[model samples]
Target: MARRRDLHPEEQALWQAVASTVTPNIRHRAKTVLPAAQPAISPVDPPPVPPKLPAFRLGEKLPPKSVRPAESPLRMDAKTHARMTRGKLAPEARIDLHGMTLAEAHGELIHFILGAQEQGHRLVLVITGKGKPGREDDHLHRQGGVLRQQVPHWLRLPPLGLAVQQVAEAHLRHGGSGACYVYLRRR
Candidate 1:
């Protein structure tokens, strides 16, 4: 409990002077009931109050935020992309990441994409096999397999992103959500 100290004579005198100058806004002011007596204790400094923040307006738009560098936007020809996704164009080479851990898959993927690009292969298949269901941390997370979720990100990031031109989800015939189609850049 906080103990109220008796006011200093100088402070009391100043307060009286200020109180005398103020007129009550309401002529019929309600009488203030005094608090019950409290036990005395050493005075502690009070914490400072913070200033109020401005309220947000309804439907106000926020300032635009910087965006992350997303994968290169659809640089391949539309017709080729359509044909590839439709499984009409078969991948020249493919790599299955079904059983590999993240590290192994990443290394193999770098090798595969770079090799395909070196060999002048335009499109290649990367089978991630949609992740497992109901399980929390097996391979990773998502509708497809654990590798399925990470393959695209790895392709979009360093080392692989430079070698790859475009990455799209596989068609049902090719493996659907379980896999991706990686289009390699020309060497």
Candidate 2:
């Protein structure tokens, strides 16, 4: 009978660590000739790639928001107001609402009156120009004249009226029939 060959020194060291009757390395090499009973490691598939996205431009502008500009605080008929108040309320401190649209004038006048009272300004001149005189044939134009005609109505309102100590048409120099001096009560 023929005897099996002995393992080399290095192979012997590895073979001692593996206690199996038949070495796995020997089985791996023998696999080329014979079928393997069990495999060591399964093959791994590669990861999939992702799609690319479009890039943004460097100078693109954003959308604008819905916002309005603040209305001007001074909108009075200066000449008319000056004549009416007789310089009682200085030009710098008075609020005139002569040519302003009704809504714009109304809002600003209310704010000014309230603010002046709060700041302890007792004498305020609000010159609302007298309405345009109506021609004999056109009575409709009478109601729509200068702010002077309209301002008294607005001043009569509870908020505005409450702040005033007196309201009277100005003397000719201050504003004549077109302007009025408003005397505000101290807060």
Best by TM-score: 1
Candidate 2: worst 10 consecutive residues by lDDT? 63-72
Q: Give the Cα lDDT of each candidate.
A: 0.71, 0.59
lDDT of 1 by residue, 46-147 (tens): 458798543445686532221111234888899998898788999889988888998999899989888888899998988877556734322233243556
How do the residues 56-105 of candidate 2 rate in per-residue lDDT, one tens digit apiece? 35674432221111111223456644543464444335776766998899
Clashes of 2: 14
Error of 2 at 156 (Å): 1.4
The true-versus-predicted C-alpha distance at residue 118 of model 2, in Å, is 1.1
